[model samples]
Target: MPRSHVALACLVAIFWGLNFLAIHASLEQFPPLFLVALRFTLMALPALLFVPRPQVPLRWLVGYGLGFGTLQFLGLYSGMAAGFPTGLASLVLQASAPFTVLLGAVLLRERLTARRALGIGVAVAGLVLVGISRGGAGAWWPFWLVVLGAFGWAIGNISSRLAAPPRPLELTMWMAIVPPIPMLALSLLLEGPRRITDSLADSLTAQAVPAWIGLAYTIVFGTIVGSGIWVWLMTKHPAGVVAPFSMLVPVVGITAAWLVLGESPHLLEIIGGALVVGGVLWSGRLVAARGAADPAGPVDVGDPGASAHAVEPAAR
Candidate 1:
């Protein structure tokens, strides 16, 4: 990969890392489902008008939306609201890599490499440590909910691969159309209409300024600009080259949360995070390093066993 594309990948990682902080801040003002509803609503509008619909079947599009947009955010936002720390939530979400590997092996009939299997084991151990460290800190259910969200993300990855849309970004944008209404209905049923109204009302108040800023960051930087750059980078370089950069997301997420939100992880949590990061790197290092050495080799985007690191936006 060129130095410039590497820099752009790092930038996207930063935006995704900062996304956790924004979610944490925004959750203070909006209920999880309601906030997600608003997010997709913002994502779908205006841009949806300008961007042509992706040339894919409706089933794949809807599957991508439900898995990625609806289920993933629904679980993640709720988990954050349920007191999953910003930094840890970011690290835990890296579970998606392992989850994606396992799912692809089973559903997509992709072979599970020894490295990937080992990576999954190491990451699962790290996740166990994370659960142990955080078990007493807060409600355990939320942590599991976030894991569920990670699984949702893995499901979305499979959907994306299956859809194989010509334009990944447009698929992402068009898929944005699926979540808001369903999420809004969920918010009404669970959070109640009165609470939703009150939250919207709170958005107009001075105290909600941070929430609004967070929303803007998520909509503008996180979704539009960040994803656009990601798509461009994916086109420019092999997915193997671009995907490893996502590993930096947790580093950025942890650091930004500590600096901005004053949320620091416990020593054990840090150790566990290290294990998780190490596992992912170990899994991808072989393929990515090979790709780096032979830049002209054809890249395999479909083989999750070999190209797990090449997938775009594992935690997005």
Candidate 2:
């Protein structure tokens, strides 16, 4: 990789790493689904104007949008709000990588490399360790739920790859259009009219500055800037090269949570997190090297939506 591309890729990692803090902050103020809806609403408005719709068939485009946009985030936000720790959420969500490989093997009839198979094994083992260490707690289910969110993202990744929209950024923007309504509907259905009304009333009554600011950051930084840069990078580079850096998010997420939110992981969680990330990184590097050597090989690197299968609809 060129030095400039390397630098840009690292910057993209930072943007995504910091996004956990953004999500944690936003969740503090707004209910998960409602806040997520508000987020997409903010994301879609201006983007709808500047980002042209892709020339792809409407079915594929819409499928890409709904899968990646609506289902993925819905599962993610719900998991986080339900008490999935930010750091673990970041780590476990990486389940999407293996999920994507599996999906590709099944759906696209893609062959799996040995390294990918080994990587998946190591990652699953690490996840088991992490789960065992963290359980017997208040919110363990959300952690698993977020893992589901990662799966959802993997599914979305496959959809995007199969769909092959004309313009990735435009496709990303169009995907943004699908999430808000479904999220809002879910919010209303589950959170209910009274609770939603009450939460809004409380926010308005208190004039919660943090809530508003957090919302802005999620929309501007997490959604537009973070995801937009990610989509741009995916267009430029191989997905495998780009995707491994997502492991760095937990490093950032945990540290930020410790400093900002005063949340710290146990020693076991820390060690497990290290194993999970390092193993994935090693596997991803192997995958990249293989791709570079084989020009005719099917490319499945750096998909941002790689975790779609793990992400459940409610969890996002």
Candidate 3:
């Protein structure tokens, strides 16, 4: 990869990694779902207005958007709201990488390799370790919701691969537009208009600065810049190089949570986070090194056995 592209990739990683903190900060007052809906609503602005719509099948577009944008966020935010800690959520969501690998096997008829399976095992073990340690910290069920959200994101990954939108940034932009409606509907159904209205009202009156900062960080830094840079990076390099950086999110997540919220990880959680990051790194290096060795091989991404290609084009 060119130095500029590498720099861009690193920047995207930083933005995304910092996003865990952004989510934590935002969830302070905003109901997770409502906050998420507000996030997408804010994100859709310039994209809906300025970005050209991509030409793709409507179902693919809708499915990709809702699966990734709505369902994934719903599960993640709800999980966090229910009790899953920020650092833990960061670790569990990496399951989406392995989930995408499995999804590719089933949906795209992609082959699974032993090494990738091993990486998955390591990552899962790490998650289990973290979960066990955190058992007393919160409800287990919500953490499962985050896992489900990872699965939903994995589904979106397969859908994106199948769709292969001609214009990835445009696709991302349009896809981003899909979340606000469903999230709004969910918020209305679950929280009721009264609660949401009260939250918003409170924000306007006294001040919900954390919510504002969270919303701004997610909308501006997380979605727009992060997704845009990711799409651009994929255009310049192979997916394998891009996917591994995702593991770093938890590093930033844990550190930021500790700094901002005084949320500390237990020894087990720390050890688990290390294993998860190592697994992801091992998976990434495996593919990248393999691709370098094979003269005729095209680089791949998403597969621990291979590389991560599922969201290669959307790593941001």
Clashing residue pair totals per candidate (backbone < 3 A): 0, 32, 8
Compare the candidates by lDDT and give the number of the best one: 1
At residue 12, candidate 3 shows an lDDT of 72
Q: Over the stretch 1-316, how does candidate 1's per-residue lDDT look in tens digits?
A: 5446667878988999999988887999999999999998988996578999887667767887898788888889999998888988888877766776776666555556677578668877887899888887766888988888877776766666655666778877887899999999999999999999999987998999999899989987887787667655544443333444666788999999999888889988888888887877787666565556756532333433334334433422
Q: What ranking emerges by lDDT with the best candidate at the front? A: 1, 3, 2
Off by over 4 Å in 3: 1-9, 136-138, 231-242, 292-316
Q: Each candidate: what lDDT?
A: 0.76, 0.68, 0.71
Name the TM-score of candidate 3. Answer: 0.85
For residues 58-124, write the lDDT of model 2, one tens digit per residue. 6656665676667667778889888778866777777766776677667645545677667667867
* Regions of candidate 2 where Cα sits further than 4 Å from its true position: 1-6, 204-207, 235-241, 288-316
Candidates in order, TM-scores: namely 0.87, 0.83, 0.85
Candidate 1: RMSD to truth: 4.5
